[model samples]
Target: MTRRSCPCGLPETYEACCGRFHSGAAAAPTAERLMRSRYCAFVKGDAAYLLRTWHPRTRPATLEPDPGTRWTGLEILDTRDGSAFHSTGTVEFRASYRGGSLHERSRFERVDGAWVYVDGDFLS
Candidate 1:
């Protein structure tokens, strides 16, 4: 069987890279990992997983990914903190979608032993 590439752009298969997080078999150990997996979830249209990994404080009541949008690529620009020992961190990235694209600096924090997305600022 052919291995499906991870949406995170990792060399590993989706099942090995971000899929583990999506499947609840593992948790993202860093902010970048969380950000990548969240992007994978967006591509797969798994809003539940997105909400599940979101910081409760910032999590909205619901999430609805645009199914019409086709994700093209992910480019990580920078990172700060987000190590396993750190409780907080940030990741800046540009994600390409079909209709357009977005560049954002996203915040993350360790919540109950897992990295959870907090919020983000869109870049102009």
Candidate 2:
């Protein structure tokens, strides 16, 4: 059997990288991991996982992945705080798609002992 690589651009298989988080078998240990998993969720169109990991205050009532968009890659540009000991953190990343790329600095916070996405500022 061939090992399928994770959509988050990690060398590991999806199951070992982000799939575990999506399945609720594990929670992301850090902000970067959460960001990576969230990107993976986007690629897979896993809206439920995305909402579950989103901060309640910021989570939308519904989510729908753009059917025409095709995500291609992820690059982590920087990170601050979002560790096991920190309650909040930020991740600066660039996610590329078929026609363009998205650059953002995303915020994360620990809620009920789990890391949840808060919001982000899109960068130019």
Candidate 3:
């Protein structure tokens, strides 16, 4: 049997991995998990979930993903805190797309017991 892979490059199927977060069935437990899910959201163009998981302080009123951008892969480079025991952290990752790629150091923080993406620094 061939198992479907998640866009985040995880061995688990989308349903078993990032789908739960996309569907709002669960919340990401750590910075890396939240980062992976956000990458998956970009792949799926699930802007609603993306906004919902964004920190209210930084979330835009609307998100319009570029139609031409096709996300191809994600490589997590590093992480700090943002665990169950910590309230804030950062995730540095490289996400590839059709024409080019994006390297970002994303920030996250737990608000009201749920992880939310706060912001990111675009890296070259």
- The candidate scoring highest on lDDT is 2
lDDT of 3 by residue, 1-124 (tens): 9988999988999999999999989988898999999999989989998999999999999998776789989999999998999999999999999878899999999989999999999998
lDDT of 2: 0.97
Supply the global lDDT for candidate 1: 0.95
Provide the overall lDDT of each model, using Cα atoms, as 2-decimal numbers: 0.95, 0.97, 0.93
User: What ordering of candidates by lDDT runs from best to worst?
Assistant: 2, 1, 3
Summarize candidate 2's per-residue lDDT along 1-124 as a digit string, tens digits: 9897999988999999999999999999999999999999999999999999999999999999997889999999999999999999999999999989999999999999999999999999
Report the alpha-carbon TM-score of model 1 versus the true structure: 0.96
Off by over 4 Å in 1: none
Q: How many clashing residue pairs, candidate 3?
A: 0
What's the C-alpha lDDT at position 73 in model 1? Answer: 88
Off by over 4 Å in 2: none
- At residue 33, what lDDT does model 2 achieve? 97
Tell how far residue 83 is off in model 3, in angstroms: 1.0
TM-score per candidate: 0.96, 0.98, 0.96
Residue-level error in angstroms, candidate 3, position 54: 0.5
| Model 3: residues with Cα > 4 Å off, grouped in runs | none
